[model samples]
Target: MDNIAGSKSSLTWAVHISVALLVALWLFPTVGLFVSSFRTADQIATSGWWSSLSEQESQNPFIRVSGDQVQEGDLYVIEGQLFPETDAEVSAWGTSSREPEAYEPGAVVDLGDGQSLMVNEAGAFRMTSETDMEGTRLPRVFTTATTPPEFTLENYEQVLGGGNGTDSMAQAFISTLTVTIPATVIPIVVAAFAAYALAWMDFPGRALLVAFVVGLLVVPLQLALIPLLKLHLGIGIGKGYLGVWLAHTGFGLPLAIYLLRNYMVGLPRDIIENARVDGATEFQIFTKIILPLSFPALASFAIFQFLWTWNDLLVAKVFLIDATGQTTVMTAKIIELLGTRGGNWEILATAAFVSIIVPLIVFFAMQKYLVRGLLAGSVK
Candidate 1:
């Protein structure tokens, strides 16, 4: 008992540490991307998100005067370019919504010949001259020593609002769903029927057929893309949703049938035999007894096929083209964004997170069945 308790304690500690590390690993980049997505382009370029919580530095441009000095209550005013001479690269800045940057806490600037000026980082400036100079305008610049935290949601708005210069993934997301849903559902429906027949309907060469389907699983999907696409075009189904659906259904069927068959064959022989004796048709047995028992397998396969079809870019690219580019799916659109707006990390992060939402939903919905399905109709 003591040994078992000690082992359990060690296991608990290990699991806790492992989970903490995993959470940190996952959260670090995701949080950075989330914060970066909400910031301006220049802010993202200049500072890390960790710095956004504190003060920052910035700059401003202004003007100065010459040949006049004005004294306010015994303070000599001297003013010139506090900012850099030219538009050079800024080194650092502070961040605070109030006061921003206060140089000498409200001191005055004295220009040569008795002119003076003062300004805060809030674009507020002051100037005085003992006597007016000949020139009409004086030039000056103010450098910002600091600023405060800033954020924006413009990146997400552009991605979802359908007006970011290109066709937004809003349409592509729906298009992917249109392709993925049916692609996942059809194969499972058809493969379930096929799996049932292969498992229970004793027929000639059944062994050979199962072997063939199993063999197909090892065949790389890339090997068949060109040939299958040629067949699609030859059949006049070229480059459309229907063609892509059929392609994915075909690709997903082998494993679907194999997995469903294994699960189905494990069903209790006596139950099937009793159903056969009770005058229930094969269809009746399948629908009533097998399907409910097979929920886990079906749910598991649904998750796989759904995720694969949802995330597919290469297949959608080849088989779903159209004249108006209306058929492009989210994956393809994201790839296009990577090529076109490669520098925009906000857009990239938004696209990635958007693409993941559906898969995450599907996983959560079906996760209970994933393990249950694998063990379905087996123990009994």
Candidate 2:
């Protein structure tokens, strides 16, 4: 019964449930981060990102009272709003820190010095004193208020270096693209030629080389960094775009060659034989026939290489970043921001999303090829 054609598996529902859980786990944080990138700092601190769409009730920090005074009767008066111009409604307020919500909005309190203060529902406050209140320190007001949902592009402006001229995420964004594009392209170019040679043409030690490439896929990347950096320094590659590109290419190549080789091996053997019989040279066959046919494999490797290189910090740190700070990547820039703007979640969230945006685009655009390419040659 279980082996019948098109029979359903007993565990299909379990698999579906597991998959749904995994997808939700991945999607929720991504959505939260995206939403958080547009939120204000206070909004982020006060409530979870999921709560951002509805009215939020929160306890605002102490706001020192300030305003010009107007004389009404024998009392001098100072009036102002607690919050900035917004639709915030004060539900409760207090004059002291310990009793932040002791008084309801619109209640008047006697301060016992022939002065009184009133805080209203719309976050407005008025203080009256028989004596002049000018040049004297004013009481701080703590309020609990409900505010409508808020979002802004100013976080992006600060992160992208539009708000302040001092931010370096913009420069870092360009530098990361500089490193990642070449690193991705160079490995795919190198690996395709190598894969075709291993998959098709007869060559000495070919089996050994294929096994070597497969073995390298399991090697810890950290094990190679120090030695590779030393070799680079000795050879005058130094620390720059060239060095980082080379570093990523080297780290990326083993899997690249392995994947492309597997996929190429599964390509119809007769096509190559026919092309060769028709007098097509090796280079011509590779460029015209092999590359075009092997696009899924190439695309898969390109996606992996691009994501790895774009997010890499250790390799960039060891092989590229110098004392001058000229070649910093997005990952490194975000770390620097962590030290400097750590308290500013809005800026941090915006920068984090910006860094992943390109990788997300690359993955989704080529994701159709990823599974197909990886599963190539598995059955055979």
Candidate 3:
């Protein structure tokens, strides 16, 4: 009874657990990136995204007090707030880095030569000196503070450039779309025709051709890159959108044909026979019958091609991107940001989220077709 065919397995719980784990593994970083994109640099550096909603308590770097000294009854007074206008509460304060938390909030420290400094939990500070001290160095304060959660759209402003239109990811985004749309569509179109021919047409060398395409799947693109590039150069299509589009088409075709051919071959033979019996030409049958029915497979290939070309850097570097360095894709722009603004994590996160959002939308929108398409010819 337990081993009966078509009955649910007792270990189905294991499969469910495995899938849940995989989803969590893939989802955590993406959600973190999305959350961090809305966060300020200080907030991101201080706490993880999971804790972003709560108050953050961390030891801040030292801040040097700066303000003009006021003369009051022969004594010099310097008054200021370390975290002016913010809701951060200083828990502990210290005058020296070595003893950063030596003093509790509101404790007063006596400096030599008739000077005294007092810091409260609200981050307000006042320094008093018995003698007039106009030309004195300021004291540095190290503080441990608890700050309220902060979220901002400034990261988006910097990445998208709002409206000023300079040094923004917007241009790179458009360039990426320009490259990816053509790259994805061209291969799908060419492969559709080829796949249908291979699946339905009784042509010579069909099996061998299918074998060749399957073989090409294992041939890494790197092996033929230089030679193919040289061919592009020889044909006077050197280093431009057209060259890159053709290159992506060639590189993406094998898998496209293999996938579409397999799916198309699995379609009911009776349908193709009926269409041909009614005097429907191959093109008519393909456009009307095959294409409409093969939507799942087409969408599956589209998603894969779109993702690959959108995130591609190597091909764009070699085939696109002229010497002026004016035409950069989003991936290349992000690399540039990493090099130039390495410490600005907020900017990187925002730009990364911008790049990822489109792909995520595409994936989720077309995901229904994905499994159906990939598994089309596997069972029957």
Candidate 4:
């Protein structure tokens, strides 16, 4: 009892730690980029957008009417100043466009007309006119507002419109789908047929073919890229959607077949034999008996192939690098954006999230099948 309890405790701890680590690892960059993407360029440069909600102070420039002050009970007062107190820089000054800030703040200077003015650091000024100088105006004050920081979704909007980055990922996303979906589907279609044959059919070279496919599983895709590209070119296919789909299908087929065959071979021989005795042809048995029993395997392989093709950059780059630039995928477009718009956090975050969304949905939708498929034929 104690041993079982201890094992349970250890397992619970392991799960808790794993969940915590995964959440932290995934959330850190995603949250940072999300906050940064909404920040303005200046704000992003000055300080972290995570400080957007904090209070800030800056200097504001304003003009004060020096003559507007009146003597009230032996008190001299001036209401306005030429600058607001805070953190701000003075860029340009103009006093008749000739003598800007001729007299610094806190200086009492004469205007050479029986008029004197006192300017303070707070931008307030007091002017004692010889005779209530009517119709006289004060000099205009100019100051820059040193805004703290701000965030906006303009980067995301521009990226979605394909105007902010090298190549718009939104278009590339569709193109990727155009390539990935077919690439994923074709391999499964072809591999399912091959798997059924290898599992049930009696052929002389069947063992050799299965071994060859398994051997092909270890062949690095990078090693085959150039040869495959040349093959596509030589076949007059050039680089296009079809080429990418075929390339992914060919590359993804071995594992697809191997996995499906393993699961298919595990199915009860009694069921297959009974189907054959029932006058069901091999094709009908495969379509009806074997196919239904192979759902778990199919779903598992579909998830793997879909995710692999979706995230692929190199194959898409090699097989779809055409002159028209019409064959680019999301990964390639995101690469281009990294080079051109590296500072665009909104674009990066939105693109990252967009790319992840499909895979996540695929995983959740087929998770049950993944487990079931892995266990298929193993029990019997």
Candidate 5:
């Protein structure tokens, strides 16, 4: 008994540790992206996102002092904050390029010609010289400072149509919504009818039709793109929202039908038959009974189709986006940003996060239905 109890305890601990590891592995990158989106480009370039939440030591190069000098009796003085409008403490300061941290904060250093500079811990600096500070070029001060964690909404604002008008994902966001809603709704509407027919109605070749749809699930979607595009062009639908909607509906139908049919089939058959025996017409029974009971299945398929349609770039490129470039979607826009603003990680992270937010919202909103469908299917 003792041995068995010890083994069980060990196994439970191992399982807990494994789960924790898996969760961390999946969560780290998502958290990193979320953090990176709020950081400036320079901060992101200099430090990892994991360090963004903590104060960090940084070396600043050639921060220029204001050229405006005030006279104090016999000496000319320049007084200013090293980092304006920031919460930072300078640990060390220097006046030359080679030795950036040569002087400790509050220590006065003298140049050969009676010029002296002092930097305080609060990043305030004072320069006094017998001669007036000359020329348009101001003196540069280099410092090592400790900066508190900083975050901003500027990246998100810029990516979502608030910045310099170009390269914003606002248009793409709208286009994705336009593509996803119709694509998800149309397929669910069509697939629900097909699923009900497959699940409950007695028709010839029923098994064969189910098998055909299952076969379609295995067929690569890439195979249909060319032929479908050609057909769309031939039939005068020709590369637009309508063509993309039709393509998504066709692609999404088989899986939706299969999922809904399986769920509908598992439902108690007595209710359906009793409703039919009560003189309820087939359409009435379907509308009033099956549709209501199959909410979980419908919700599951809607979430699936919405996510797929929203994230798809290849299909949008082939069917929706034309030479005019007006119908671009979020995924396509991210790809464009990669090519054009590849170095701008703040923009990229913000754009990617913006694209991800909708699917996450939909998933969470419909999660109860999704979980119910999955559990119902598994238990039986």
Candidate 6:
């Protein structure tokens, strides 16, 4: 008994550790991206997002002291604040580039010509000379300061159309929505009808049709892109939302039908047969009985199709986007940003996070249904 209890305790610990590790593996990058989206370009460049949450010593660029001289008791004084916001604590200061942290904060440094400079911990500096200061170019000061963690919404603002609205993904976001909603909805509607027929109605060659759909699931979607594109062009649809919607519906239909049909097949046939025997029309039975009972399956397929359409770049590029680039979706916009604003981590992170937010919302909202449908449809 003692040995068995010890083994059980060890097994429980192993399971807990494995779960924790898996959660961290999945969460680390997502949390990093979320943190990076709020950071400034400078902050992202200088340090990692994980380190951004704590105060860290950083070498600041040369900050020039204003040449504007104030007269004080026959001495010329040049005073200025190095950091406007004073959010950082100055640890050291220097007058030359070679020795950026030559002097500690609050210590005065002499410049040999009856000139001296002092910088306090608050980043306030005062430079005084016996003679009037010369030249329009001000003396540069460097400092090592400990900056607190900082976050900004400017990246989000820029990506969402705040600055100039030129590089914004707002239009693409709308365009993606335009593509995803209909593509997700139409496929589920069509597939639900077809699925009900395949599951319940004993039509001729129904088994062959079901087998064909299941076979199509293994077929690669890439092989169909060019052929479908030609077909669309030949049919006067050309390249637009209509073409993309149809393409997504075609690609998504097989899985949707398969999932919903299997789920509906497993459902108690007595309820459906009873409805049929009670003088109910086929449409009425499907609408009132099958539709309500198949909510989990419908929701599962909706989430699947929604996410697939939302994240799809190749299909959108091939079928929807044109030379005008006006109908570009969020995924394609991120690709454009990869080429154009590649160096801008904040922009990339914000764009990526924005693209994922909708799918995540859909998943969380319908997760229960998704799990239910999977469990219900699983082979017992």
Candidate 1: tens digits of C-alpha lDDT, residues 182-208: 999999999999999999999999999
**TM-score of structure candidate 5:** 0.90
lDDT of 3 by residue, 33-117 (tens): 8899999888899889899999999999999888889999978999999998678999998989999998988878997889989
The TM-scores, one per candidate, come to: 0.76, 0.89, 0.84, 0.69, 0.90, 0.91
The count of backbone overlaps in candidate 5 is: 0
**lDDT of all predictions:** 0.74, 0.88, 0.88, 0.72, 0.88, 0.89
Model 2 root-mean-square deviation = 3.2
Deviation of model 5 at 366, angstroms: 2.5
- Give candidate 2 regions above 4 Å deviation: 1-22, 162-168, 377-380
Model 1 residue 131 distance off true place after TM-score fit, in angstroms = 13
Off by over 4 Å in 4: 1-22, 38-43, 49-152, 163-167, 370-380
Q: How far in Å is the alpha carbon of 29 misplaced in model 4?
A: 2.3
Best by TM-score, which number?
A: 6
Query: Lowest lDDT 10-mer window, candidate 2?
Result: 371-380
Model 1 spans > 4 angstroms off: 1-15, 50-52, 55-117, 121-147, 165-167, 371-380
Give per-residue lDDT, candidate 5, residue 223. Answer: 92
Residue lDDT tens for model 4, 1-380: 34675588878788899999999998876677667667655556555555666633333334445446675444434445454433333433233434554556566666566656665555455666555455667555433333434457676666667664464667777898898788888899899999999988998999999879878988999998888888888989988888888889989898888889998999999999998888999989988888888887888888778888999999988888676776777788778768876876556766766677787788788888766655642323
- Which regions in candidate 6 have their CA more than 4 angstroms from the true location? 1-3, 110-115, 130-135, 373-380
| Residue 255 lDDT in candidate 2 | 84
- Clash totals in order: 28, 0, 0, 5, 0, 0
lDDT, residue 300, model 5: 83
> What are the per-residue Cα lDDT tens digits for candidate 6 across 310-349?
9999999999999999899999999998998888899999
- Candidate 5, lDDT over the whole model: 0.88
